[model samples]
Every structure is written in C-alpha cells, then in structure tokens.
Target: MSALPRLSTIFLAAITTLVAVLLYSPLFVPIVSSFFTISHGNVDWSSPTLSTYVTLAENHDILAALRTTLIVGVCTVILSVVSGTLLALYYHGRRSGRSILQFIIFLPFLMPPIISGLALLIFFREIGLERSLLTVVIGHTVFVLAIVYRTVLMRLQSMSRTLVEASYDLGATGWQTFWRIILPNLSSAMVGGAILAFALSFDETMITILVTGTQSTLPVRLWAMMRLGFSPDINALVALILMFTVLLCVLAARFLIPRQVATERT
Candidate 1:
C-alpha cells in the first residue's frame, strides 16, 4: 500500500512538471531567439553576440516609436490614476445614479478590445477629434480606468473608517483629513495602479492601431514590422521590453501585496 501511494505521488509530480514545461515552452522560444541564432528549427551552438543590440540603436524609426509609446504610457498612467481615484472617492458610498455610471466606467474594460477600439474610433469621428497621440491617450485611459479605479477603491474600502472618523473627531478639517490621512494611505495603491496602467499602455496595440494617426506606439510598430518578418534588432528590443515589464510587475506586487495583507489582518 505504501509503495502504491508513493508511485501515484511520483506520477502526479511528473504530470505537473510536464504541464509547466508545455506552458513555458512558447515563452522560451522567443527568449532563446533573442540571444542565439536559430535556423531550421535548431539553435546554433556556436556562440551569442550583441550585434542585435547595436543594430537596434541605429534603428531611428523604431526608437522614435518607442519614445512615443513611453510618452503615451506616462500620460495614460497620470490621467487614469488621478481620474480613477477621484471617481472612486466621489462614488464610494453614494448610490445616486452611480451604479449605472460605474457600470459605464467599467464597460470599456469589460468589452472586447476590438469592440472598444471600434467604438472609440467612431466616437472620435463623430466628435471631429483628430486621430493622434492625444486620441491614443484617451483610448488607453478609458481602457485602463477600470484597473486604476478598482485598485484605489479596494484600498479605500480596506482602510479603517475609524481613521477618517478619528480625523474629524480630532478637529481636523475636511481638506486636512484628506491631505493628511486619506491621500497618504491611498498613495501606495495609486502608485501600483499607475505602474499597471503604464505597463498596459506600453503594450496596447489593438485600440491604439484604430485610434492612431501619424505616430504609432511601439506595439503597433512591432505589429506592422512583424508582417514582413522581424529583424534581429527587433528581437533585442523585445528582450529589453520583457525585462522592463517584469520589473514593473515586481514593483507593483511590492506595493499591492503589503496593503492587501494588512487589510486582511485588520
């Protein structure tokens, strides 16, 4: 009986290992290609070089697109964080037509990206708004607003009502309470949400492609280039972006996890 149980446990462990390998193999293919040469379904075992990195530096068009992407990402992060936080505060406990409005706020994120992209494209045309980086920023803010709002609201709800009540009980004015207590407590969540929003904006391509005018973001540019096959430098850029995204995720987790654990303990 003991031998049978051990054999079954070993079989389950082997199956789990096989599943993990299957899931990560697709990711491994790209990371491997970024550094080493692959030909005819085989990696060259000779050596690796930084030639791709050098080539990426000279690719001014792609570099320009990357700059544009960064600008849009920053703008999206700022707008979404500010607006989402304000909206969350405004609607936290109030129920006056807010449920429907909140639903509208979340609709863009809940809908498919293609649908949201098309809707925004049409809306911009109706409003005579030129399809530019500004339009892209608007699209990204709308798409990511839900994430920021949800993050901030979760933090706000987790906060002790006693903290705010104590502020008032201690003779602090409304602005004083907000500035000293509420804002400070919510700051970490806002920062984490901003990072998440920026990361999403950096990689956003579907809505951006529809709403973009002359300037395209990095993901859009990559999509265009991918149709004609990727160059070596593009691989280098992908490697860098993957690393940056991982860093952002780490930073976001660092901020979000502690707040969540504290909330749970409280």
Candidate 2:
C-alpha cells in the first residue's frame, strides 16, 4: 500500500498487460483478416466482407470434422466423469497403494502429449485396436481423466464427513447415503469437471492427431488446412469457437463457484 510498493505493483501490471497482448496478437491477425480482404500478404483496409462465413457454411469437410470433435468431446466428458468419480470414491481413504496408483493415473497428464499419444498408439496396436474415433475417445479420456478425478476428489475431500455419518444415523443404507447425500454434493463438481473435460477434448490436437484414423477433429483438420493456407471461413470458425469457449468458461464458473460465496454476497 506504500507509494514505492504501489509503483512496483503498477509496473508488474503493465508487464502482465504487455505479455497478454503479445500472446493474443497472433489471434488478432486471423480475426482481423476474417472481416477484411487480404492481398499480397497484407490486409486491404478498405474492403470488409462476410464471405468467409458463407464459405465456412459450404465447407462440408470442416463441418464433418466439427461434428466429429463434438462427438468425441461428449464421449470424453461422459467417460472421464464416470471413471473419475468412481476412482475418487474408491480411493478416497484406507489404502497404502492408492497414492502410488493415483500417481500412475495422473502420469499421462503429467507427461508430454506426444509421449502419451505414442504410448497409447503402441498399446492399442499391441492390443489389436484400430486407429479410429474410438481410439481418439480413449486417448481423450485418458488425457482428461486426471482433471476430472482431481476436481471430484477435491470436492469429496472438502465435504464434511459428519454429513455421511448423520445420513447413516438416520437409518440410511450405504447406497442411500451415496445416492441421496454424496451424489447431490458431488453434482456441481461433476458438472464443472465435465465442462473442463469437454473443453480440453474439444481443442486437443496432439493426441487426436496421433490416435485418430480417417475421421479428424476440428483442430486436426485446421492443422492440415493451415499447410495449404486458411481462407476467411477458417477465421469465422475461429471467432465462433472463441465465443463458444468463452461462454463455456462462464457456465463452468457458474457451476463451480461455491454456494457459500453466493450466500455471503446475499
């Protein structure tokens, strides 16, 4: 709060702003080009059009890839949520090996994507699994499992043990306690995890590229198209995706923010 400290804080804020601008500069180029004409590696400032959006609608291949990405995202969310919640429940307490196994569960996420993808690719080939959407789903699930598991586990850890005890003292069976008491508390965390998982799966490119077959996700498709130069439609698609991602983040925060915060504010 002192003057010198305040100046230091201002300098730090300025540095952070510059870093953010540097990071977003590349994204601005595509978005800017989407609205205007580009000629000879430069944007034609006088011309502005929505032709790219029209082109995007007509591009069936990209649309198909987009569909594939959505499908994979949904599948990944479902699988990761189920498995992660189960793992959290199973390993919540009473085990010496659980920590080691949890580390193993998280290894794929901690390791580089190329390494994880290569390992999975080889594992699949050895197990006779084909290169396809199914493989992509599995890869995505593995990659996202750590996030889902961590989120659910944190919620579980934060929940008061007395709640479970009180439920049982009221003559609730184990199943009843889990279904009525535990699941309700976990619902928000599960939803938040699902959103995070879906977002990661939606944009996952490295593992998808390695494990995918003929059906490509949007990111992989975009990567291939970039080699041939992107049209205006790609920028339109990027803009739409950015908007959607922001919306998803807002929804996720809504779900994940603790109810106690709302109570306090009110």
Candidate 3:
C-alpha cells in the first residue's frame, strides 16, 4: 500500500511539472531575449545589455499603446468594481429573480471572447456608439464584471450576519451600518476583484480589437506588429509586462489569503 501511494504521488508530481513547463516555456524565450541581443534569429547570450529597455522607452507608438492599455484597465477596474459590488449587494438582498439576473450578468463572461466581442460590436453599431477607448473600456468592464460580482458576493455571503444585527441593535441606521461595517469587510474582496479586473483588461485583445477605433491597447498593437517580427524592444516590453503581471498575482494572493485565513479562524 505504501509503495502504491508513493508511485501515485510521483506520477502526479511528474504530470504537474510537465504541465507547468509546457505552459511557461514560451514565456521563457522572450524574458531571456530581453536581456541579450538577437542576431540572425538567434540569441547572442554574451554581453547582455539594457539597450533594449532604453529603446522601448523611446518607441513612441508602443508607449502610446501601453498608456492606452493602462487607461482602459483602470477604467475597467473602476467600473467593474463599482457596478459588480452594487449588483452583488442588490442580489444578496433580494431573492426574487436573483438567478435570472445573475445569469444575465454572467452571460458575457461565460461566452467565448469572440462571441462577446461580436455581440458588443453589433450592439454598439445599432446604438450608433462609435468604437473608441470608451468602447474598449466598456467591453473590458463587461468581460470582467462577473469576476468582481462573484468575488464580492462570496465575501458578502461569508460575512457574519451577527455584525449587521449588532449594528442595528445599537440603533445604527442602514447607511451607517453599511458604511461602518459592511463596506470595511468587503474591502479586501473589492481590491482583489479590482486587481483581477485590471489584469484581464490589460491583456484583453479580442474585445478591444473589435471595439477599438484609431487607438489600440498593448495586446492589440502587439498582435498587429506580429506580421513584422518583434524587435528587441518588444522583448523588453514583454519582460516588463511579465514582471508586472507577477506583481499583480502576488498582491492578489496577499489580499485574498488573509481574508480566507480570517474567515477560517472565525
């Protein structure tokens, strides 16, 4: 029995390692090339330099795209968080039509990105809303709204009812209880959801491509640039984005883990 268990564990570990390598190997090339020069389609590992990063700073088009992506991401985060939180709160307080409303809210997120993008495209055209950064922001917000709603809703569900009751018992008004007790508890979940929303928006390509105007976000610009092979500065940009993505993951974990631990303790 012990030998069988050991063999199973080893098999699982091997499979996990293989999956991780397969998923991450492609990213490794860009990160490594970001540090060195690529000559004749091969990396020259000797004499690594920061010239590529300097070039990235001077690439006006890429910088503009990066700025646009950041702007869209921030706008998406704000809209998604506020709207999702409101939806979550509203659903939490009501029982009638909750299931249908939730399904509606989640429909776009659950659909294929292409399908969602196409739907949004048609909707915008029907309404005569020109595609622009605003449309991209709306697209991203719709795509990420479900995540924020689910996060905040879960947090709301996990919250202790006793806290709310105690506030009422102390003669606190509805607004006072929400402001003093509920919002504070939901803060971590909101932050985590905002981070997730921003991350998704930053990397979003299909929806942005469909809804974009003259300006494009980073991922869309990168996709367009793929026909003309990537430069060293592109590699540097990828490396920086990878680092930023890792930092967001770390921050998400930092906020989410403590809430889980505290919930478990309570």
Highest TM-score: which candidate?
A: 3
lDDT of 1 at 183: 96
Query: How do all models score by TM-score?
Result: 0.91, 0.93, 0.94
Which is the winner by lDDT between candidate 1 and candidate 3? Answer: 3
Predicted candidate 3 versus true structure: per-residue lDDT over 145-247, tens digit per residue = 9999999999899888898999999999999999999999999989998998888889998989999999999988888777687678888888998989989
Locate the minimum summed-lDDT window of 10 residues in model 1: 29-38
Best to worst by lDDT, what's the order? 3, 2, 1
Ranked by TM-score, top first: 3, 2, 1
Check candidate 2 and list the clashing pairs: none
Q: Indicate which candidate wins on lDDT.
A: 3
lDDT, candidates in the order shown: 0.89, 0.90, 0.91
Instruction: Please give the RMSD of candidate 2 to the true structure.
Output: 2.0
Give the C-alpha lDDT of model 2. 0.90
Of the candidates numbered 1 and 2, which has the greater TM-score value? 2
Clashes of 2: 0
lDDT of 3 at 31: 88
lDDT of 3: 0.91
Q: Candidate 3, clashing residue pairs?
A: none
